[model samples]
Target chain A: MKRNSTWKTVHRYGVYNKSTGAKVSLTGGFGYDYTDGSTATRGFISPNGAWFDNPTVAFTAAAPTKAVTAQNEAKTPYTLSWAPGKLSKKVAVVEALKASGPNFFTAWVDNGGEVDVRITNNGGTYEAKYYTMGTSTQIANPFTASVGDDSSSPIIASEITSNKWLGWMHSPEKRTQIYWAGGASISFYQETNMSADATLLGKTNGAGNTGYTTLYAVENRAIADATKFPVEAATWVASTTDAYEYGRVNASADVRFYFTALNPPAGKLARTLYLDVNPAGPDAGDKAIMFNFSANERSKEYTSFAATPVTATLNKTGSNLRISNGHTSPWSLGIQRWQVLLTPHFTSGALVRLGGTTQ
Target chain B: MIALKADGTVYAMSEPMVLNYVHAASKDMNENKEIVFVKEDGNNHNPVPALCTAPTASRHYPGGTTDVVVCSVEPSDFGTKTYKLRYNGKWVNGLPDMEGRNSENDKNGFRVTMVNPKAGTVVTHTVGGVTTNYVLKPLAVAEAFLPESNAALCNDINFTTVAQFGWSMSDLPSATMIPTAIPNLGQSAGTSKFEVLGRQWRRISLSIRAFS
Candidate 1:
């Protein structure tokens, strides 16, 4: 199972009312991922010098059973089926989410969060799939059934069965594109590891299937059908002045994609998506580090934020940041080594080491 | 010049310099170069910016409690900086100088942004037509009923009241009974002069009644 390396999170503590079983005296502390590896393996030694395994808890699956069903579809042992047209298929999937029960997923529906119905030929022929954006947990249906066998007329399937439900996270093996609906909401990213010796999307002939090359497609609203489909290189828009922005992360190039979507749903605040891409390829002697910062404190987001480098002068205030280090797979920690005191509070002899892809 | 790369790495744009601070008071070398001293030597130094300061002890409010800790960081060539409170583990940043005239702006001092996640709320306070937004964490109802001594455990926006009065449950002589003998109760009794004191006492009583 993939380890939980959440960059930003909150830990709430409170007293419970014994009679009503209700929470009282609720208090919480905000926490960031400070360590590199799973505390289980890295462990920890207390001030007394007694070593013990880091405290860990099972990943409580988010409620509204459908959310779990949808996430399961994106993992291993599941292949995403494609649909001919995504319009009607999206409606059926939304209906299933609405009926699934009241959870953050349903809250998104109540807020009129836009649902994008994807009907691309993602590794195979199947029906349309739609995923809700801006929810605590994003849910999508990569159904198993295929329809419109005949090319003359396409059939729009309306049935969204439990077996067909899958999560929005796409399988990387298929070299599929993951769309991040950019807005005020926090971006939930499942760790995607690109191995050094592993085969990438590009082919040996110096040509790459655009499907495999373009890994992340970020936009707040729907894109033109012409630009989104046929999985071609020309379809990915790269203009800085455009309403949307995307990155084709070549291994050697350090590219920054700046996106600000002005037109957001009412009550939704549009934000700037700053993605500093460093792909794990042959560059840097086989290691890469990717940095993504999109939200600010007002949004109460977890993923990434503006990163200020540790300076020798100590002029700028060091922010509480979550930096994912390592260019290799399982992107653990301790890739680059340098020590800088984060604040004046540090003792004269104390040194805090910062890890990074480059320094 | 030390420049920050896109991936948050510090690189030498010019000749590399040691990241150390020389304290002016004692002329001692601070190896880490992070802590800013009130006085620094003539050499170029990085000092922590003192944006705002909060009380170390909890500041009791009408309905809640809050404590503040002051931290400093040296200003960098980079624009605005962000910080996380070690006490609460919450991220805070300085607000932009919207008026471009007030001391609360980046030029004078920074305005700290606070967020209360549970309420998903932001409260903007405007004074003299200058507006600043701050998130107010929800104060539990139980806090409004705490004995004044124990009430200083909650958190809220900073405010000061000119007049303050507090009477604890311990102030009363008996917890279960009301005194029967004219209740001497620290006040003059049964005279025209006492009538004036009684009126003043009644007003204090009403204010306390409205508070609870």
Candidate 2:
């Protein structure tokens, strides 16, 4: 087998030799060729006798295969790998693979079989491959590792607690009951704001004639405090000679009493005020005074001393009654003493106790 | 009546008048004559008669007569009920007398025997040839439920976390049945249900940075 010469250069035109009966020789820039049995000099020829101006051939290397470490189910660090080869200056790209979708690269490193990758987000499958530089191969299968928000399969949940402060009071009527009675004397004095010691007097005769009783001076002046009386009380003239004087009398004397005030304790409910008079005569002619007092004063009297075997009855009118002086003769009856009773009424109920720590 | 202030102070007044009841002066038959009731329209003054039945005029008799007009009433009538006594063709401006004879017989005027009267219990009173009947109805008491303070955290949750939990007063927990429990929500086993004025509350919050 004969080996063919390599061509150094090629010329566009062919040359002919006239001496030595057409000697054939190959030059640097020309070639000897035979065309239709005619000797000629032409452009350089390839070893395979093909034209030299043909396109150049190219050599390409195969893509490297990749293998990745199992992705962590938690937020931990993991590894990625590729098939070993001549260490190229190219870098390997690591990326995370979305479920059945495209891969997103998080980092890149020099070409190596195995590279460490860190996952900060939720964890899942990952992909890695060698990066191509300045060519169609520049893009590589991204290496990625799965990351998770938390370590548990299902996210852990927390519970919440709360507290509140309260200020509470029971219904006022349900707390406690207050019994109260208040009344004013109907004497000429008509004093509504009398001292605590003011005495109300009534008289009775042997015949049980209920007549007007005398309103003596407000006794116990020494014990009376100025603060107890209203401003109007100071203007009244106190009787000098007969500190105690008799009121005008009639066949049937009727005296009236009125309630001045009714105040119950906090958390207590007031029922009613009961009024009755105590006479020196037999317990034959006393009547009940029925009235209600709240924050205001009342002008009505519920009971009267008209005709009697005076049995105490609940007086709805809240009126004043007369006591029989019980005197057969006008001069026969002397000074008699009588007292009025004022009692408060209340309903029995539960009491509300306050002031304590609660949760 | 006692007035309670927000600062926890109480002020009381004596001789407080009964709400809605008014007094009118009347002519007296004799000096110091006991006038049971009076009616005045700012123009005319009339005295209510002694206790006699319906269709009969009130008669004025000597003092110390046992004859008296009797009527029954309830405790709830104190502030809400209106009474008009009649004498001599005029209506009086006072409630009826409900005085018992003595302590042993305590059933006086306006007896409050039952907690409340049955529906349609009519109370009738005849005076001055006119009879008026009053029907007793159930009393309506005022009630309310209030929050006293902000809910505090009972657990590790902080205020911010508690806020994040979307806690609301409408979602308050079921209160324990006790005297201290609020009405409608919780009340003691045997006690009557009282109205709830207010209550204390609690809440919880949390801040999470690490998992454990």
CA lDDT, every model vs. true structure: 0.23, 0.21
Best model number under lDDT: 1
Q: lDDT per residue, candidate 1, A77-135, as tens digits? A: 21111111111000011111112222122112222243323333322322333444311
Model 1, docking class: incorrect
Badly placed stretches (over 4 Å) of model 1 are: A1-104, A107-245, A249-359, B1-142, B145-212
Model number with the top TM-score: 1
Q: Please give, as one word, the docking class of candidate 2.
A: incorrect
lDDT tens digits, residue span B1-212, model 1? 01122332221111111111111211111111222112111111122122324343443222323332333322222122221111111212121111111112122322221111233223233334554443323333111111222344434324453222244556667845774545464665558767777787899899999999
List, residue by residue over A207-242, the lDDT tens digit for candidate 2: 322221112111222111222111111111221211
DockQ of 2: 0.00
